[model samples]
Target: MSTLSLAGGPVSWGVDFADATGNPPYTEVLDGVASSGLRWVELGPVGYLPRDPGEARAALAARDLAAVGTFVFDDFHRPDAAGRVLDAVDAALDAIVETGGALLVLIDRPGEERAGTAGRATLAPRLPDADWARMIDLLRRSADRATARGVRPVVHPHAGGFIEFEDEVERLLAATERDELGLCLDTGHALYAGGDPAELVRRYGRRVEHLHLKDVAATVRTRELGFWEAIAAGIFCPVGDGLLDLDALRTALDETGYDGFATVEQDRRPGSAGDPAHDLRRSVTRLRAAGLG
Candidate 1:
């Protein structure tokens, strides 16, 4: 059995992608995290919390919790998106350092609302090969910037993003450096994209610096509904309650001797509400039972 520190984030409660404007306040989410036995949390959607590093630090300190990473969704496919992407990353550095060991999570912003069974059929958005090269360059530069800030840069292959597919993930990983750029293997998205988590671990586990331990509901997964629609329908369920072969994934991580934080992420979007604390606690319990908590 391999043991790694378990963390939880605002996304666990739907206090996510849309940020504070769409969900509960930071303080409340942070409190929920602490109360739920999560020692670390992510600085979800940059502006969702107090922007100032000092203010952010104080808030987390008050709860005795810390920020493990920060998510930055940007239009990397746009030819001119690099500057804005770098700017977002720069803005996050101070707070990231303040939170300690926080990685700059770079996620490609899926431009449109991909919904329904059609959305499920097409997990990828159109990003030209030239644009992908440009994005890769930007990612390399982003890694440089993060290194300068004493933080790490992690590439997140989101389900609705341009890099949702396994081959896309492989290409990105091949272009980046294992020592500099890290991979944030989001289990739910990878599974949703039809990639085997255990195989991914065997292939690129060495570059994995962060993780989002999410489970896709087996029933909803087969429903073939669009990403957001499925998410809105409470499709990302508790660990053991879902279909992921977590034991196999855990064995893969154990083989790698993974020591980084594995934050239990149950994607909860607004209007798709439920008892998040209870769900998160259930995930923690399940992880512990699997010896990965």
Candidate 2:
């Protein structure tokens, strides 16, 4: 059976970006993560945590939490922005490595045009051939840099991003060497993009190096809301209370001999009412009951 370590992240507490308005203090988010029984965490956005390696390490250490990785959401399809994106990746890499993190989750940030049509694969515009090639090249370079630093770089196909669908994911995998870039399979995002998580595991197997455990509300799947609007409407629910089949996912992982960190991510907006810790604790309990924690 695969050994899965349960981790948490600041996104559960609505801290997507450092400068995102109304973001709760980092200390509060860490407190909530540790309080909810998670021992590992991803550094949310670069500046959301302290930039200094020592300080970042100290922060996690203070909460009795170890670093699993960090998420870098940037536009990789534009050659003009490649330098800035790479610099962001390096910044994230520096902090993650210093804090004992192994995975660097790379996500193509969603543009306004794609954001509204997220999960509508038929309606979403495809990247032009040159832009697609640029994205693949940047992914290769980013993965190489992360590998050089002894960190595993995993491409995360986010709901509203350029690489959210099965075909895009397959294309990316075909273009990059497996050793250089692995996959961060996010359960909710996979379903939201109209793919089955277990089937993806059966197909990709070991290429999926990391996991993000999230549950999408089935009722929200057919809604016409934008990404952020859907989130605001409670599109992501607690584990076991939504559409994901945790049992099948666990079985698939075991069958494939997959072992790694599976972080529970319940994306929410900052300043939303209700205790985020309560939601996290509920997810941890449900996952444990499902034999995933």
Candidate 3:
């Protein structure tokens, strides 16, 4: 197996792409990353790329950054649902292939309001058993398609998204039975949802396809904040500055023998000086020392 390594992503830094000379051009963003001492990057989406792959590849080549994964959303159970879930996945897959990305991250689930109000109105319990089964089946099929095209399907759990709770995570994991259908372990989201990311890593390390290295700020005042609000408020702080225990997470990963890209994630606004490269460099250094990189 390949040794674990560090990689940078564009989402967490809240990059100021608007100010760059090449507005909305991936080359500019990737060039900045290369200058920041990163060898790999998780490109946000192909939509950010130029019309031609030649241009995209040339840009990345200049930075020596490899495309690791792409963020994707889909409804595993409702393939034919009114929503554009499947169509979105198809389009994302096409883009993933174009960018040489091998992983598609799943970050969507049924909305709780759609399920019904059962007190808290969580989506997990509201989902009909049959629909749950269909969703799992859909995921399995999606996994097969991705595998056929040399891409893996990784389920990313979000704090406020449809399947944010721990129970919902368990249900989704139990419903699927394919090696291709894996988990994208997200630290801050798990913490926000009152779930232990390290424990999940220990329990499902074999299924861990990717990772979103996030840290949460838990305080007397912020502990009760909603998930989305926390994200929008720059809830994710630097690795050691937050509530997650990196030592525990590293221990779990070591025990499980898991190997994958561990990308830093923070959603703070970009400073006037420029991109948050200094903060990201600090995070990478700390993560490497902790043995996650």
Candidate 4:
């Protein structure tokens, strides 16, 4: 069997309530993940589960499930005097340490402007030079803290966000110490940002610590939709259902000996997981057919 651990996350079942001030509940999403035949799942959008480590652990235990990772979206470019964003990362790491998760996914919080008026990705805002340094320093600090806490920190280059473009990703990789920081290679986002997934993995596989195996539908790209609009328009499709040559990507991973959790994240808007459990099963079956699962 391959060393890669195949899994799925909340967004697959439309469970990401990241924009809401508070998460409504988690039973449906957790159960959905467990029942979808994925032995592992990620703790999506912090605060979706109980903040108390003990409760979170028990919740997963009850489901006979293991956590592969937890997503932490922080705006390093925007921070308050309260140090809340850093504190939130600490909280996420604390949960990961206690809940058997090893990867802490770091994403930039660029939703507000990126999803403005049209609710589409504009890619308008660029961080100032000082802010770029600020973001890198924060990532370094966060990585060091996570290292002390026993989890690896992986940056995700999200669409319509600060690090969406390939050049920006290159800059981030250049600025951060490779040993301390790695990337969550979200395949769909890479394609949406106009980068080839197989090529990217071939070049940067060493810096990859975690994976979100999402396929993309580039039809939305021609529409020039916003980030949220594209997601709502099915920018993320199932494995083997879009533009990605998943088999080729898997072959590349094999050559690189990159064994890690490959969580299928077919991102959808909240409450938009129409027949998603079936879609997830089919997706997994597709990956298995391609020697992925």
**Count of steric clashes across candidates, in order:** 1, 0, 2, 4
lDDT of 3: 0.66
After superposition, candidate 2 runs with Cα above 4 Å error: none
Better of 1 and 3 by TM-score: 1
Candidate 4 lDDT by residue in tens digits, 27-101: 777787777778898988777788788888888889888998787776766644127778878878877887888
Clashing pairs in 2: none
- Model 1, C-alpha of 258: deviation from truth (Å): 1.2
Q: How big is the positional error of residue 150 in model 1, measured in Å on the Cα after superposition?
A: 0.8
Better of 2 and 4 by TM-score: 2
Off by over 4 Å in 3: 15-28, 74-83, 109-126, 220-223, 268-275
User: TM-scores, in order shown?
Assistant: 0.92, 0.97, 0.82, 0.90
Which structure among the candidates has the greatest lDDT? 2
The candidate 1 region of ten consecutive residues with least summed lDDT is: 113-122
Error at 45, model 1, angstroms: 1.6
- Give me the candidate number with maximum TM-score: 2
- Enumerate residue pairs that collide in model 3: 76-135, 77-135
lDDT per residue for candidate 2 within 1-293, as digits (tens), equals 88899999998888878899999889988998999889999889989988888888889898899999898888886679999999999998988888899999999987786888888999998899999999999988998899999999999999888999999999989988887889999999998898999899989988999999999999998898788888888888888888899899989998998889999989889987668889999999998988887
